[model samples]
Each structure stands twice: as C-alpha cells, then as structure tokens.
Target: MRQAPVSLPLGIVVRRTPSVSRWAPWAYKAVSVIPGAGAADWQVLREDGDVIEYHAATVPLELWHTDTEAYLAGLSARVPSIGVVMRDDDESAHPYEILLATASPYECQDYADSGEELLELVPMPEGLVALIRDFVEEHHEEEVFVKRRRDKKRIDEVEDGRGDPRITQLTDVYRAPRAGRPN
Candidate 1:
C-alpha cells in the first residue's frame, strides 16, 4: 500500500550577531522554526544591541512515507531536532538563503556531507514533534532483518581466465610478458 506524502509550511528564524573578528562583520545562523507559518523573507523580528533576529523564509517541511524510518531515528534521538538547510546568497540582503526544514536526521546528514550547505539542528517544537510522531507511527513499519545466503555453486571448478588465451602451451600460458620481449 502506498501512502501520500505530508507537508507543512515552516518559517525559519535566523539570528545575526556582530562578529568579534575584523575579517567578517556578521555571523548568521538559523535559530528556530515556526510551524504553520506564513510567507516571510528576511523580515525583522527583534533587535538588541548588535544582535538581530529575522523571520528568514518560509519553506515546505515535507514528510514522505518512504522516509519514515529516518523520521523514527530523529524522534528517538536524545534531542529531536529539525534540520534547517541554507545556502549562501551573495545578491540577497541576507548572508544565507533558507532552503528547507526537515525532520529526518538521515536527510540532514546528507546535506551536511555536501559541505556547501549551512545546516543547523534546531530543537523541534512540541507541536511539530507530536505531528511527526503521529505521522511516523502511521507510516513506519519495522523492517525485518534478512541475512543473505551465499551462492552454493563452487567457483574453483572453472578454469581461471587470468592466463593468456593466445598462448597454446599450458606451462607458458601463465607466464607474464617480459620487457623487450616481442612474444
């Protein structure tokens, strides 16, 4: 049986703080995600001293039936988190562009492996957690472990193909070509 995919609109909360170093002016990171949030793009939420928080962007947080196993892994974690994926954007006002929000830790690892993307693990909201838990419960099935048995055929019975087929002599068939030897 196939199940339809689920999705929710999530708003990414990004915080930018003044950097202490002279090389960079600001440091940006995704702090949290708001579930069922409307469209937003770098809208300022708060400002204090040199720190500023913005509702960076709203993106679809999708949940697939096939990825329920990954979601299960995230739910069981010590601190269940939502992976916020962002990418660098030079032309945009913000340093990074919010790409997506995901509940799967496995998918988060994939984004992290890319190294080009900025990935953050924000604590999952209680409501979001409950929603994912319900989805996982419905779609996730405990996969059975099946050990694979080796083939019964004996490979030693066949003649190895490593020997040169052109050499008619059985003894010299396996002889490797020497330097300056024409054959």
Candidate 2:
C-alpha cells in the first residue's frame, strides 16, 4: 500500500494569559525573549489553569507566514527579557488561531517580511519531533485522501504491459543500498 507523504513537521502554537500588572500587548512582547519562542495569536480567556502551555496546536508549517516572524521579532525587540501575552490581529482572519510565543522576534519579523509561509527550515531536535508526533497521533486521526498528480507526462507512450527497461535499470542502480554485503 502506498503511504501518504510523511506529515510536514509541526509548528507549535503557544498562548499565555496577560498578567494583571501589565498590558496584554506588552505581555506578549515580554514573553518573546525566553528561548524557544514563536509567533502566536493571543486571546483573553477565563479558564482556570497555568498561564501557558506548549504544543497547544500542531499546524501545517505552510499556514504560518513571514508576518508571524515579523510580529515575533517586534515582540522580542520590545521586551528583551520577559514573555508577554499580546493580542494578535492576524488570527482573526483564520478559521482557527493558536497563540504562540517565540524567543527571537527579530527572526520572526525577518521571516514575515520575506513573504515565506513555511518554517520547517529551522531544524527541530529529535525530542521535539517525537513530542509533536505523539501529540498529533493521539489527538488526530488519519484519513486516506486522493493524491494529486504532477503535470509531467510519462516518458513511455507505448501500451505494452512492460515499461521502459531503462527506467527500471536506472532505478535499481540509484536505489541500491550503500556497500556492506552479506553475500
């Protein structure tokens, strides 16, 4: 059976409640400095619990854009040492929004300004990948979906059951495992 492409790496969304002493927007700026911070949408919630949690949502990297990076950078620059719970206007436009915090706001801002929507270039450590994969596997169910086809035409035009022999030979050569033989 064919498998779906491995799911894209997860982008974490973090949220924090504003402290009573500080303004909500400023709170977000404050939080952007602690290491492992990323862009997030903020909301004032009345729920009971800790002020923040990690891995609140595992979203496709494509959903996050350079604007998130800029916002994070601006937040980090504004408050170099603390994590603040700031209100994010960008989330309002999306169907679902998650609040997140990041350590480097400048990097976030740079990414946003570049018009890039994906964030996977930043390699994730193995532990974090495991954490995210576990979260997704536990909370989400996989569905089999139709695969999209590429635009390129097939090299073989003949209707014969056999394919081009050259293709199989090339594939065999390319896919052969590295040297270390049992034979």
lDDT of 2: 0.37
Instruction: Assess every candidate by TM-score.
Output: 0.86, 0.25
Judge candidate 1 at residue 134 and give its lDDT: 96
lDDT tens digits by residue: candidate 2, 40-122: 33333234464553333333332123233332333334333211122335636432333323323454455456553322123
- Output the worst ten-in-a-row residue range by lDDT, candidate 2: 26-35
Which parts of model 2 are misplaced by more than 4 Å?
1-13, 25-50, 62-87, 90-109, 112-123, 127-183
Across 1-183, the per-residue lDDT of candidate 1 in tens digits comes to 776679899999999999888999999888999999999989999999999999999999999989989998999999999999999999976689888899999999999999999999999999999999999888788889999999998877645335766767646556566668797
